[model samples]
Target: MPRHLLKLSDLAPAEARQIVLRASALKRQADSGYRPFVGKTLAMIFTKNSTRTRVSFEAGMARFGGHALFLAAGATQIGRDEPLRDTAQVLSRMCSAVMIRNDSQRDQEEFAAHSRVPVINGLSDLHHPCQLLADLQTWFEHRGDPRGKVAAWIGDGNNVCHSFIEAATLFGFTLRIAAPAGYQPDAAVMGAAGDAAQLADSPAAAARGADLIVTDTWTSMGQEAEQQKRLQAFAGYQVDAALMQLAKPDAIFLHCLPAHRGEEVAAEVIDGPQSLIYDEAENRLWAQMALLEFLFGIAA
Candidate 1:
């Protein structure tokens, strides 16, 4: 059976590590003038607007010598009366692969369940697998190894945070997430991460000696209406200079871009020294390109 990248943890530790290695090789090959997806077509399904995810996937397919067809939710019958399963069943036969960015994992899972082609989860409320690929790639590029390093997150344990926890557990890293009471990660994710954080007394204590410090917006896009409330709930959890200084001196700061100026993170810390965010953003394209090739089982 063909595999899909819906959640980072869905992959075994070995599989996740191989994706990072494969993604790196793909990056080097692309830089050296190799294009593999020539004449092929990729169907992209977007339920939300995006800057990085949109351009990265489109450019990735194109760089591999393929054409990416951008399909919007508004333009499809999905917005009117069509079922997601029906859409997936139909699209599977028309495109080589289907990449979807929507609000929920349930939607993507159902789509993949009904489709014969590979279903790439572009982004979901539960996980951002591709983004984490770029993130892990950047970590290796800058920090050398992910094993046993402390990577602390201080903010809402949203999609990105949860994915980081999963990655840390899978890769045997010390991941410390400091979120307010109501904004903690899911119980299952926390349990898995706890099983992996045995290197330290506890997860929070594990973050004290981290080599990387990461964070995200206090509230995501669709949660704008709850912005003020989130700010109040996430107080004292900002990744400001003081908090960032808690990590090792060489620690790198990462964010997925389109960051909030003062919420969750300070502007200087994100735009200043030790920030690997630009490379992180650039790696999104390369990492995703490699992921597609791997899922397709292209000749090594």
Candidate 2:
């Protein structure tokens, strides 16, 4: 009876758009004394480190008048070899909803399968739907509908790239991803996305005349050991001024934050006038509040 947001494609296109619209509305009324979760609780289980993901969800719950319980996987039985099914069942009983940021998509799937409450995937190796929701909301606010717009993704084809691929399918945008040969997105995901997505051999090629330019770190959280190798592979892929020039003059730039200053993007570009990085970061709260309201069936 409860909805689960395990991936972006889990929602119909209309439903996804509705959530984005709601996020915009919520942002307008952020200080209007709204508290939809006065007597509710949300359980946030984290198996990985976070900055925006943890803060946005926790703050969003507080703003909704709900209590958010932070559970570090290492401090809970989940890290002590307890079965995920048990954790899911226990939390579903005590909490209004459950969120998990973990490495294995299968584990999140198993947890959602047994959860009696709504389940949200905060983060996973396969997809990052929440961030994509915020990104979509930001784009919509600035440029209206993204349908037929060109979105260029330059850098590692990680989870964020994976979600962009799904978004291209759902939102009718063409996504051009430029990554090193060995770092391309999963083949099945690309296959599913079909004509909505394509691969480019270079960042310039992808950015050419694009309406929106986005990128992420060359190395992700769990890939510290391969940092040097990634640096070498992604040597020419940084979203610098030259890359930005390839896109339309007024094209907006975005990067999901905690960005390495001189790595994935140049200092000037991320801090420049064209970057919507800060707005994109702040929208995480508004966008996720809409998701929570949707899952809880609350009308605003």
Candidate 3:
């Protein structure tokens, strides 16, 4: 069976840590002309639009001497109602690996089950594992191991937050999340994390004494219909200068971008000195390269 990254928990703690370390090394040697993936091809399937995810994966493949094929769901047979299992089997036969950015986690799992090649989750409604890898790499680059650190998540406890909860368990960190009552993360995900994750009464409570602060857009791709309602619900949860100040003096801020500057986060904080959003974004390439190497059984 091919190893797949369907969620953060799919990787053992040590494996995840190793990937981050490898990513850091790859970042340093980015211009060294190394090409482990020569002649290989990665098939990328997208059910939703993307910017960073598409660019980072395509760039990573090109930098490693591999080719990447972009397949929009609507342009492919997938849009014609062909089963995902059939598509997965076909892609697995022709491609070295498969990366999918889709809305349903169940569909992703079904595809992965039928795949012969490693399957990577670009993003799903339940978790954004790839983003978590980049976030881990960025954190490690700036602050070393996150084991004993406190991370505060402010805003809707959506997919990113769910992955962060899993990451806290795997990486041995404490994750405090603050979301409006109806917007809290999935109960089962929080339960699985046990004491590693907790709920705070408010954003201020979550940020207090935290070593890392994070947030994401109030309205995600498929949530456009609920935009105005979300805006109102998340009005007081913005990660502005005041909320950031509640964390430790040297604490860093992270966001899975395409940010609503004045909404989920403040422009000052996102573009501020302590914010590592760019680094976090750039690490997506290196982290994903490391992931590809791991999936293909390539030596670092």
Candidate 4:
């Protein structure tokens, strides 16, 4: 059986680098119309609606000559019908691997807990492992190698922030996370990232001398109810022209997309020359392909 990658920390820095290198190779082969995962089947379950997650995983599987079975929450007995353990047991028997995009981080743990096969986390409240894979891959591609680079994460320290911190520590980058006074990353997650050089402070403070700076929506999907409150909390946290000026002149800005232009990140920055957001989004496919190749025993 293949090893399950349930979190960014699941792979050591070396293993994570291997994942990216393998993905790049696979992408080249795939782009040239090679298909290696013939006769394989991957099961994807989503309790949350997806844009890139669904398309990337499905397209990535197909790129390798595999089939992806996308299951909606209502189609399966996840939370509403059968227990998660039972669901996991059943799916593990029928599928080579399972990728789940759900709500709680605990649900991901429960799914990985019962499944004997490789269980991948598509997203959760606390982490998004696939994204970190892409983020790392992007950094690797842009800089050819991310060693010794100072990466900064600006704006709200949400789930993406948590996952980014963990990836930073694992990949050995000096990760500086800048959020507002009351919007710091979860202390437990921060402790878990294990970055000796990780620093959390204001956006400008983190941006200084950073090679990569990232931001995400101040208000996430499930937190629409707290939109006003989040706006107030994240008021001056925007990654605008002035803030970008604080970073290294060659520093690149990153956003996970569906960016609320003029809000969390300004329209000019997200669409500007310094932004690598589109490349970051494109890396999602290559990154997940790399991860899926490993989970499916495809030699990543």
Candidate 5:
């Protein structure tokens, strides 16, 4: 059976660790004669706009000698009456794998159910497993294993936060999330995290003694209309130098990019020496490359 990484929970603890390790080796290999995807093709479907998602997957495929076909929502019949199952079945026959960045979790589930090849959740309303994979790889590069470390998350408990919660459980880390009253993560996700995750009273509280500090934009792609409201609610949640001071002296900061310079994260913190945001962003390529190799059964 083909494996589908709809969420971090899809990979067992050992498997996730192996992927991280493989990502490091893949990065070292670079484009030095590795061509696992020669003659293979990956179909990429984008229901939402993208930057990193599109570039990383396209580049990764080309690096492996594979082709990536980009399909916009309206460009394909999926925007009209073509059933997702039909799209999945048809694509599965032609492509070696499928990756989708969508607005709904259910839609991704439906696509995976009908897909014959591996299906990767490029991004979704409920999870961004690809980003989490990159983040984990970054952590492993700087520090050793993050199994017993504490990671603090600040700002809106959005899709990225949901994946962090899942990662905490799968990677054996403690996740401390501090969000405003009404902006907490989903109850079911929090419930599933159990003792591995907790809500702190404030960003400072969560960052206290943490090994990693992470935050994302207060408003995501679809929440543009609520930008002002979200800005107000997340006003005091910025991951600035002051908050970083509360964490371990060696603790690193990370922000999934296209970040607002002065909003969710302050300029000083993200641009500081301890910030690993750029490295984290670059790891998306290596991590996804490892993922594709794993899904295609080319990696041990």
Candidate 6:
């Protein structure tokens, strides 16, 4: 049986910590020409569009001397309704591993269930463990271990927010999330976080005294149809300079990116000195490289 990362909860706390630590080390030696995955090949399947997820994984594999095969779901047999199990079995036989960015978590889980190779959830509707890994690595780089720290999430309680809830449980942090009534995170995810996660009455309440503040685009990829309604619902949820002022003086800001300047955040906040969005984006490559190494049992 092969280990698979279907969600953040799939990794034990210690394992998650190890991967983050290894990612930092890998970042330091990024140009050292260490190629543990010299002969390996990664099959990347994308059912949804991506920027960071695709480039980071592809570049990470190439950096490790491995090749990556990009398979657009629409262009593959899987688009024609070839069973996920069949695709999983065939890919597992040839690729060193598989990474999938899709709409359904259940589909990814089903595919992973049939895969002999390690299956990584690049992104899904329910969770985004890869982004969490890089986000944690960025936090660790700036502010040491996050255990006991406070993070504020202001916006739609979508996949990224859900992953943050899981990360709060695994990393022992408190996450304050502020979302509109119908847009809040899944009850099951929050329940799993126990006291680590909390619902805030407003963005101001969530950001108050927080060490890290984060938000995402009000309209996600699949939610284009709901843009106008979402804009109205999330009116007071933007993480602007005023909202950021409620946080600690030294608090940092993060967005998973392609940010909507005036919608989820202010241009000043995203491009300001307190923003770590660029570092967070760059860390995706290093963090994912470490993840690939961990999945393949390569030496640190």
Q: What is the TM-score of each candidate against the true structure?
A: 0.94, 0.99, 0.99, 0.95, 0.98, 0.99
Among all windows of 10 consecutive residues in model 3, the one with the lowest summed lDDT is 136-145
How accurate locally is residue 143 in candidate 5, as Cα lDDT from 0 to 100?
A: 91
Query: What lDDT tens digits, residue by residue, belong to model 6 across residues 146-209?
Result: 9999999999999999999999999999999999989999999999899999999999999999
Q: Poorest 10 consecutive residues of model 4 by lDDT?
A: 193-202
For model 5, name the residue pairs that clash. none
lDDT scores of the candidates, listed in order: 0.82, 0.94, 0.96, 0.82, 0.93, 0.95
Q: Tell me the tens digit of each residue's lDDT in model 3 across 112-188.
A: 99999999999999999999999999998898889999999999999999999999999999999999989999999
Residue 124, model 2: Cα distance from true site in angstroms: 0.7
Is candidate 3 or 5 superior in TM-score? 3
CA lDDT of 5 in candidate 5?
92
The lowest-lDDT stretch of 10 consecutive residues in candidate 2 is 250-259
The lDDT of model 4 is 0.82
User: What residue pairs are clashing in model 4?
Assistant: none
Which residue runs of candidate 2 sit more than 4 Å off their true CA positions? none
Q: What lDDT is reached at residue 14 by model 3?
A: 92
Query: Could you tell which candidate, 1 or 5, scores higher by lDDT?
Result: 5
Residue-by-residue lDDT tens digits, candidate 5, 1-300: 789999989999988888988999999988589889998899999989999989999999999899999999889999896999999999999999999999988999999999999999999999999999999999999998999899999999989999999999999999999999999999999999999999998898999999999999998998999999998999899999999999999999988887998999989999999999989989999999899999999944
- How many steric overlaps are in each model, in order? 0, 0, 0, 0, 0, 0
Q: Candidate 6 — what's its lDDT?
A: 0.95
Better of 1 and 2 by TM-score: 2
Assess candidate 5 and give its TM-score to the true structure.
0.98
Error of 4 at 10 (Å): 1.0
